[model samples]
Target chain A: DVKVTQSSRYLVKRTGEKVFLECVQDMDHENMFWYRQDPGLGLRLIYFSYDVKMKEKGDIPEGYSVSREKKERFSLILESASTNQTSMYLCASSPSKSTEAFFGQGTRLTVV
Target chain B: DQQVKQNSPSLSVQEGRISILNCDYTNSMFDYFLWYKKYPAEGPTFLISISSIKDKNEDGRFTVFLNKSAKHLSLHIVPSQPGDSAVYFCAAIGNTGFQKLVFGTGTRLLVSP
Candidate 1:
């Protein structure tokens, strides 16, 4: 079975703290993505990596950065947590651009 | 601006009945469409998909119908069970490879027995 695992299910961070959200896919897929889900806003892409060390910004990449040094791992970093940034962050992977994506359980982050 | 829209926020259906969820998109460049089901505290799961070339696609009890002219799509779940209750999101992808999908706000479905 294909699985995308996120490092945390819930997280709390101070307003000025820097936070990291890790994701690993065992499917060996080439494309990995990070999206933040909010009520009434749906899911907005943050960043995605098409290959190792290749990253692309999604619609909302402000105040965030990503790393993809390894093939199966992609990490989303919050440079500075803010209260408005609180939301459910999701990680997904797909074999290719035209394929359906498999998503992780998601991490609900609360920035105080 | 929201290119994809799920006008209905929620829908209720009886068990053994068909539940229909509708979605509309403003972008004509979108060529592929997908439907995802998400439960509370979990991520969205891919349900079904249809490309612009095909008007309909089916998987077991789930069916997705596309109307290219109107930029509309619908997901029909037959004999919906209580377990089918979840939030449904419709997504559209452009021709860009490594498809970056644009999603709707999602419609919550509740199936009652």
Candidate 2:
């Protein structure tokens, strides 16, 4: 079965603290993405990696950064957690030739 | 500006009724469109997709229609059930040779039994 796994399901962090969210995929997909879903904002892309060590900014990448050191693993970093950053973070992966992307279960992060 | 837009914020429907969700896009470079279903606290799942070459694509219970001229697409759910209640997102991918997706603000669907 194709699976995208997130390191944490929920996390609560203090303001100004640095946060890291990890994601891994079993499928050998070349493209990985990070997105945050809000009530009315839907899923806004934060960062995406097309290949190892290759990263690009999405629609929103102000306070977020991403790392793709390996083929299957991608990480999202928050420089300083804030209350507005509290939202459901989703990780998705897709093959370079395919448009269908598979997503992880998601991590609900709360910044206090 | 949002490349893709789902103007409706919410929709309610009775069980066994048909539910239609609309989406519009402004970018003409988008050659593929997709619909994703999301539940509270869970990640959005791929529901259906349509290519620019075709106007319609159908799965078991979901059908997606694309209108290239209008830069619009829609998802139709037949006999919607309570289980179908969730947030529906419309997404698009340009012909940029990569799978970078652009999504619109979602439409919350409520199917009451």
Task: Tell me how candidate 1 scores on lDDT.
Answer: 0.94
lDDT of 2: 0.95
Query: CA shift at B74, candidate 2, in angstroms?
Result: 0.8
Candidate 1 lDDT tens digits, A2-112: 999999999999999999999999988999999999989898999998999999999999999999999999999999899999999999998874469999999999998
lDDT of 1 by residue, B1-113 (tens): 99999999999999999999999999998999999999999989999999999999999999999999999999999979999999999999987655788889999999999
Give the Cα error of residue A106 in candidate 1, in Å: 0.3
Which residue runs does candidate 2 get wrong by more than 4 Å? none
DockQ of every candidate structure: 0.75, 0.85
lDDT at position A32, candidate 2: 95
lDDT of 1 at A26: 100
